[model samples]
Target: MPYTGPQSVDRALEMLDAVADAGGPVSAKALARRLECSLSTAYHLLAPLTERGYLVRTAQGYALGPRIPGLQRSLMQHLEPVPRMADVLAGLRRATGAEAYYTAYRGGLITVVDTTAPVTDTGNPFTPGRETRAHATAHGKALLAELPRPVLRRYLAEHGMPRLTRATITCAEVLEAELSRVRGQGFAVSVGEVDPAYTCLAVALPRGREGGRGRDGGAVHALSVSLPTGEFRRRPQEIRAALAQAAAGCG
Candidate 1:
């Protein structure tokens, strides 16, 4: 069989593990010697990893960064607050009579990690692992709005804003302008873009107190509510307020 594992990912983890084993910062020279890689290669990997918050550069050397704990928290399936998060989502659903979704935006993709949708709403299309329509979803827009300028520019360049509806922002300039509004308003709105009848309101939560934002300045997670067009129009401000309030609790 072909060697299928991600080599870079494996190396990065190994570097992190090696540092953890030392119980303190590990210099690049030591890392290169331990990993049996060239000094240049070790430094190369260290630079990007540090930039992305996977590792931090210290006076002694490189050490694991604060963001690692948040990533670990996300992966720990048996963690305690999962039940609380479920309760929060359930409450959001009940309050708006709409589906509540918890989403994470990372690695240039949006992943819907969880949701609380009413059984009666079979037409609900979003689910975990659905491809992100960054130009058309409130969660996507909210997260995208937080991306650093360089990262955001690269993202739009790679994934040109394909229109899903007449309301979708297609031009880079327009999208930037809209993202500015999202940042200013502290939320994002998507109306009939992903689906003709559905509207979504979302708020981006702070990544972690220690890590602040990701290296790219984007939010690590977003919470959103999707509802029918008529209902959204009826109480858009009310829904936005509820989402912002819930997001505060999360932060």
Candidate 2:
């Protein structure tokens, strides 16, 4: 296919994604093969990234560089929620005995702004980053439920509904029906859609004045709690009450 886009910039970004996905130092040859670019092209791209401190060459291969931390720190700073919201999430975690997350829908994406979990819990999957599968997660669905129909259609068009698990809604029609239920009930639930082992429930907060601007105007915010599937099934009402209280406290 003809490359109509800015090829260099696109390839450079893809290279970075490939490296991050590798989870460790990856060789230039490996990156070239993965990206389906020539060896010389890979080196040409790597040289600039290495010079910019975005990638570092090690004995094993090229790994993420010092600049990555600074970039992540800056992003976190920009996405940082109000101090009170963090407190609310912490309290929700304590009250519900589940992982609590504060999410925002902004810039055509959903982001996990903050999360709180028990001190001993080490297996939590949700993190502070962009959520790609908005169709499959409770927090994402809560925010999506609030979007105007046209906006919702556009979002689905851009980020297609990908199946994360057997329970994930892959069909757009089915997902819209689920979102309708969320709108009616004022909450959303993820029964092992993101991960089979866990269940999550979420409630959207009132629209925010800043960020999250879509065609409709304001940003979307949401709070969610996650627990083991068995535990969630056992105390669904208890967890829902705690989540509601936390959302109210944030207001």
Candidate 3:
């Protein structure tokens, strides 16, 4: 089904996506090419976005504007976890000596809402935004495992499973089998799927009256811990135990 809504609004949103995807300043000509529209039409779409502070015109080209951070802050406010969830994540990080993350599936996307500050300079890969590689992420898999088959199919159709690493499951059938295993085992694991250097283990938090519901009436929240692949493999039981404890605390 094609979008039957207003064309201008759809194109404006697409233009913003193009700018974000560029990862740097992008020119109107490049955006026009990406959006499959004329340069003039691109400018028309850019004008409102610029005026609205969603994009900024830089000497190099158009870049994400300051307003983007404000939107993120507002979103975080709404998506903030229960007060104790942060303490729970912090305790999990200390207990397992790994980065702890609290993720939620909302608006058809998985987002890391809260996380313990990186213990090392390596920094955290799971940030607070739309997580693209659901097929290769433990928190993503935990949430995806709870979705109904039809909703899962729609998600895969919209966001094709891209091979981020050699370990990433590119085949949908294989991923479905993996998700089935996650459902049976009550947890999800990502071993070098997103990055060969790291591994993640995650468990879904039980759904409650306060914890939001998903399309399949399953818990939308998940807790995950990430560590170096070697350390993760060496102490898999310890990591899983910490993750389960954190999930229970959050629930």
TM-score (all chains, Cα) for each model:
0.64, 0.80, 0.72
Q: Better model by lDDT, 1 or 2?
A: 2
Q: How would you encode candidate 1's per-residue C-alpha lDDT over 170-223 as one tens digit per residue?
A: 888888889899999899999998888889999877743123443332336788
Best by TM-score: 2
What tens-digit string does per-residue lDDT give for candidate 2 at 82-103?
4577788878988998989989
Better of 1 and 2 by TM-score: 2
Q: What is the lDDT of residue 120 in candidate 1?
A: 49
* Best-first order by TM-score: 2, 3, 1
Residue pairs of candidate 1 with colliding backbone atoms: none
Candidate rank order under lDDT: 2, 3, 1
Supply candidate 2's per-residue lDDT for 170: 94
- For each candidate, what is the lDDT? 0.77, 0.84, 0.82
Which lDDT value does model 2 have at 220?
76
Q: What is the lDDT of residue 27 in candidate 3?
A: 96
- State how far residue 38 of model 1 sits from its true place (Å): 44
